[model samples]
Target: MEDKFIYTDKERKLSYQILDELKDTLDKSFLENDLPMLQVQLKDSVAKNTIHRNVFGLNPILCSLQTAAIAVKDIGLKRDSVIAILLHQSVQDGYITLEDIDNRFGKSVAKIIHGLIRIQTLYQKNPIIESENFRNLLLSFAEDMRVILIMIADRVNLMRQIRDAEDKEAQHKVAEEASYLYAPLAHKLGLYQLKRELEDLSLKYLEHDAYYLIKDKLNATKASRDAYINQFIAPVRERLTAGGLRFHIKGRTKSIHSIWQKMKKQKCGFEGIYDLFAIRIILDAPLEKEKIQCWQAYSIVTDMYQPNPKRLRDWLSVPKSNGYECLHITVLGPEKKWVEVQIRTERMDEIAEHGLAAHWRYKGIKEEGGLDDWLASIRAALEAGDNLEVMDQFKSDLYEKEIYVFTPKGDLLKFPKGATILDFAYHIHSKVGNQCVGGKINAKNVSLRTELHSGDTVEILTSATQKPKAEWLKIVKSSRAKAKIRLALKETQIKDGLYAKELLERRFKNKKIEIEESTMGHLLRKLGFKEVSEFYKQVADEKLDPNYIIEEYQKVYNHDHNLNQPKETESAENFEFENPTNEFLKKNDDVLVIDKNLKGLDFSLAKCCHPIYGDPVFGFVTVNGGIKIHRTDCPNAPEMRKRFGYRIVKARWSGKGSSQYAITLRVIGNDDIGIVSNITNVISKDEKIVMRSINIDSHDGLFSGNLVVLLDDNSKLNMLIKKLRTVKGVKQVTRI
Candidate 1:
């Protein structure tokens, strides 16, 4: 192989090593096609200026091919996968076209290569790829999972050789990609060794000192640690042998990055870490006895070593959501050091190592586990379409930890960690979740947003009045919960829109006006509504007042109808006012003084919210009435400002009034006896103030009430409220 190579000596050696690794797995047809393609790739590497090299100084095309080949062999991929790996980068670097690959390798290989090339272009602009970019890359190649396998292989190979590259910046970029993106991806795909190696190499390059320190510590203690592991496994090995179990046991140490993580999490040094080693027992058993054999292994190991009941994880009884099945236990070993022990059969170990791809490889076999359902859900989510946000959520769901919770009937259900009761209800059924107002976790009533933990018995509480709130979208973490909440909100919005449409039509009918499309369009624009449906939705939800539509319609109707009619004649004599502020006011016996020149004008205080003399007042001209005075901050001001700005006029006091005005005071205080009595005394003591009504409420050591009083001006009202605040037990007092 090396003698036929036209590239560098190192490249020839690496390519041969890759081919050798695959030789046992691949057949003769694949090998014959691979050699010619390899030669063509070498020639094409020079023909096209595919001369650009990665930081490792290897030609991009050759490096990618090697990486892809190594991954295919490790992943147990077949012929088309191997061919796709070889030509995946060929079409992307302008060395050859997709048509050429299709002609040479057939259409199956061409499609996979096409998917990979398309993904390459999506993130080519972003030099530093993160988990999000990886997700998009997955989506781009989701049509063919083989493309993703090749991509992950390409990433693994890059991380493997990144440290040797002279460019530290490129090394850091690749390290970040490995740690943040490819490592988790590998883990999801069930390539545990590849995942661990990617993570370790990333830590080695990203945090050099910490990596070396842990590495050196492990290396220095290797001999002593190996001896302890041997001593600990000796008893379990003997017991398993005596039990007639056909099994192989091996001692395994934790990865360096994993150990560093434990140190950071537990705030401890390396020496303080326990369970640094694990003994795995892989059994050779028929499918019928696999579970029994695994449990038997567990029993034998525990009998030999006193197992810590708290450290037992029985995944065999219920496999992880990712289809991971095993029984793990921590036991007291020799020298009192704790050692973890894993029990599984050969098939379980394969699934544990290879993930869903393993299931695909063994799909024709009857022994395939529960991965079919999980994969179905994953593929459904991926095929849901080109929604980037949903893809982000799907990516998050992939990495979510599985937590097993129980129902009131003791039925077990699995959910992501940090999933709320709302998520749980939705997982049961959409209707149950939609009507769920609260739930009882372990018989304690909790809100719908309460996060559930493992082993808690949950019972949902539903109400006919309960409906999904927009805020629920933020509280629920599961994609199902989020999707359901969004759907419920949208349905509610559409329902309200229909009701709003009816309400608007009824109002128009009552006003003897037709609901014309042209008029409605004009009305929506004038009211600042972008769409008619939005306006109707707001009206149905009671967020927008229907009166706004009627008022604006009337203005438009009058403007058009009066265009041809003669305009009304007016003179300075008709507006007889000596002072502008008193123009609309007529003299009255009440404390509200008015201008005598405006004697015939009909005027009154607006009752929606009373406007005192010192308050900022606005006069609105009514159809039959001369003027109505309202507070500037009145609730009706916004509608008036939008629909009838011309009807608004300024009004002020004549500075000659001595009458009293009623105002409401809201007061809160500590619920002490005689608190209300003290408040009344303060109000009554003011000679200029008159108390009209006092309402007091006290409960649970807290008192709140409203007081209505008459005062000459805002100054007097503010003074009275302030004096009431100084009373004992009073926390806050405000004029309403």
Candidate 2:
């Protein structure tokens, strides 16, 4: 092992040989379409060199794709499918482009590759990476159903490579990502088999101790269960075989995570978890009579093993929202062990495995609101504008439960289950939302944050000058409202600056202060503003009060150090940042650190890893000298905070955020009267101050709501609470 690498003869054969075929297949597929452009990019690489040299060495990267190609071929991938598979990782690695695929393999191949490319394994920086990644996967897949399919194949290949990862920590990281991000995605797409394997494989690394224990338990009971399942299926098998039918019957145990979750939930032992295993019967029914005949097979199976009524899930009738179909029933077997059985035709099995996407056989079949429809909606929305709306809708539609509600206009609006009227309002229009005063659900006045159920018709109330309230954020769920509220808050701050400037001009005229841009410029510079707009925005957002600005202007015009830079001895030195401030991220000077969590002190996870328990961490002194703690591994902490490590403090959660921080909320939707007063009433308790201001901005039939203050942490905030939480004519709350 030269670099201590353990690649063997087996690895060399499996990878190199397989990749050669994959490369040839891709070349063939691309050549079958346009040849010149892709050839040039391909030729850019010298022989014996790599196409994606930056990310991996020529051989190793190629070898990974080759393994994928081999697996694809085994699964009967065609030319476009194999080429797309080969090009998958390279796109994100920046070794190639969609244009390369289009030029070489034709538009169709490029489309397929693009679909697969939609599944993200790449990285980026954001305060909420998992939520953002989830957002991206949701929106991307809505544009191409094939993305889920490709992700499935990618997971398959990654699972196989798990054993080869030498680093214990690295293995766990990869496995945990697979467990949380990939496995759920597989389940959402209805790829049960892939879901099972991925969850099991991930669990092996993530909870290895638990995994081995579960494995041992299953192994201990394997023989007896196998014998009993065989006997249980024997009668049904004989009946089907006697009927000249062809089918495959097999049993599988639930994965470790599933069993663990069940055990924790039900407070049960392995023996108490009787339905941990299932017997699946795959039938050979034809397409036309498939549904009817599948029920017949179900009837036969039920007759063989007495079916439990409560445990029977008739998904075979309605099918899952993802288009998964199969008759699932739990039966009392001869041993009295509960046996779960699934009876489905091969087509149903395919659909069950692939979700709405598996139904498309070729280009000709007319799909019933198929994957293409969803993908088209996503792409169309992206192209149509409103990125926040697109991102929100994508997240709502992609990951979990979805519901559809109607507006007064009779237009059907789809939303995540438990979506608030605020979400609905933002869905309508940002301007209308900004002006949203209130709303009526089913013709009865309901809070803007009220969760709309299926078929509920909402009539939004609005006001032209209505402002977004801070409390609505506590209730709204959809990101649309959050985004709108944020944008509106920004826009309102600018507008308010303009308004303040007008007011100041009048005051200057009354006071006989000369009106000159140069004088204003000097005053602004004295106040430490980069531009007049910033000054105006501060005034508009109430970060600068007109009285303060006027007094400050007088002082600057008259030489005032009373406020600008107070003596170091002043208590204000300990007070940092704007009061009722916009939490804009910045690089600060004067590093200092303190643990708010010490005794009854307050602290926060310094925007990196949101340091939970057991994370290697450190603290950094910020300009405010307010101690900010970060995971020692935080990227920014290493760069900005580490130089002065003395400021960093060790932080652990003392339970959760006390009381919910009175953080202001932003809601944007339709504009009508009373949106402000209504929302205000919700969080209007005496202890809660409006702080700086409430902002209302509107444009093109949309309104945005913004409330600024301070508040508690996330779990305390929610959509339902947002509606009842308060805001007038509020459509949605957007957090900036």
Task: Give each prediction's root-mean-square deviation over alpha carbons.
Answer: 21.6, 30.0
Give the TM-score of each candidate: 0.52, 0.47
**lDDT by residue for model 1 (377-440), tens:** 5434434532111222333223335555566764556677788899889988889998999899
CA lDDT, candidate 1, residue 575 = 46
What is the TM-score (0 to 1) of candidate 2?
0.47
Give one digit per residue, the lDDT tens place, for model 2 in 178-277.
7767676667555666777788888777777878888899999889878887888888889988767778887877778799778879998766787878
Candidate 1 segments exceeding 4 Å error: 1-6, 20-24, 28-34, 47-49, 125-137, 140-142, 361-736
